[model samples]
Target: MSYGDEHRYGESARADDELFGGSGQTRTRLPDRAGDPYGGARRGGRSSSRSLVTVVGVVVLLIAAIAFANRGGDGSSSADDRGGEPAGAATAATGKRPVTTKTGGIPSGFTHDAQGAQSAAANYAVALGSTNMFKKDTRHSLLDLLYTPAAATRLRGPMDQAYSAEFLGKVGLDSNGDPPTGSTFVSRVVPVGTTVQQYGDSTAKVAVWYMGLIGMSGERSTDPVTSTWKTWTFTLQWTGGDWKIAADSQQDGPAPVPGDDRAATSDEISKAIDEYGGFTYAR
Candidate 1:
């Protein structure tokens, strides 16, 4: 994405097209918003699903806000003032500055440190698990962008086979990665947090905890939108001054017990996803 192009975050209809490429055939309809952001409509009814997202956002912000009550985005406080947390223990939000430039709308040029590894892991998780992974063109573009050249060459064929037409049909999408007409296919990855398992001058192993949404939204759709929890561990290599994936794996998550919240209607789920953009996921 160029500086002149519209900026976006998260993999939704417009964002993916602008950042990666065509992800699907459907378009979003945002009917309400008091301020009319992109002509968006007012938010819909309350549901456990909606409340969960809101709560998570509040929690993350609250933690960052209270992480160092005496400190701020500007790092005025030192380790001596931080109760001397173990030298390498993951500290609360450090108010660390994020990279200012972007590559394909993806934050890039991470620092050479543990904090940089964590940030790269979180952002990469979101990009990899995005809807763009389904389409061939965008998938290739993304693989080129997110993976080390050698990794991209190694995974191309396997990834293409994995998202074969038959697999897409089972997931209610066409060979072209489009949902049935009148329906919207939803695929998004929302990162919860990141942790560094190992870090070195040339490489890092990092894990990302995330919640993913995948399904088709339509009045008569059989596969309604749903969510899943997983942790993705990525092996990142420092190449060309960027952290690119060398290898990655995923596993079932430490998912929280489900709350007694009613699932949102398809329209509600669809609208909510369209209205709420994803974050750049920085410290």
Candidate 2:
């Protein structure tokens, strides 16, 4: 059992539920300023009370506004869900198409080859960092999809060993890779950005900066939830109608100072992890 075989948690999986709850659909009304025009002139006693209500109303509206904006692109048909604009439309919209016609299964033969490589690099980073890689079946499929044949074969054995049953147990999963009852396993990788250090007709070097979630959800779990910054560099080759990894490596951080925010409880963390879907990173 692999992570992919387990349920995918996150915002992408929340279509059936209202965001932030059904309260999201409720519109908050600020008191009519005209009606309260003279209210501010009231004596100190009522003034404080009125001001407090006004402040609370404003805060509610602010929260509602922010929630609405965040929900805008949450639908299934959004552009990011569909892998960006159509090929010819993308090419036509931006004259920056690649010069080479094809690199991998993705459009590589753009007039702007750099853009294509960057696109491939970003998507590759997402796929490589996905939870799916924890499962044997999905890992093999992903490796074949993203790596050169030789590299895939070479990596499969080692990857299997790395994600062995012991590792799964450490992450709070059973031998079949399922999270324990009432717990959620979180292992998501989100690319923060991407850059290309080198590009050519045959090869490119791309670096992806990402934040990853790697921990178990349970009261006694030692790992607890945490995030780390990493730079994944891929040396890619044009192979079999797509870009394939020749080699890859990772290094820690361009990290930021940790904030003083209190960590969430295990249940809250698990709920949040299940409710927030990942993104297909773009430049």
Residue pairs in collision within model 1: 31-41, 32-40, 32-41, 32-42, 33-40, 33-41, 33-42
Model 2 ranges with Cα > 4 A deviation: 1-112
Q: What would the per-residue lDDT of candidate 2 be over residues 1-283, giving only the tens digit for each residue?
A: 2221122211121221221111001123564455544564556878889988998998899799767644532111112211222111111112232333432332233222444555566667667556676678887887777777877877777777777898777777776677767766777767665555555677666556677776778877777878878766666678765667766666667677999999889999988877886643333
Worst-scoring 10-residue span by lDDT in model 1:
1-10
Compute each candidate's TM-score over C-alphas. 0.69, 0.59
lDDT string, candidate 1, 133-251, tens digits: 77999989888998889878867787777778987887788999988887888888888766555556787666677888888898878888877887776777898988888777666
lDDT scores for all predictions?
0.67, 0.58
Candidate with top lDDT is 1
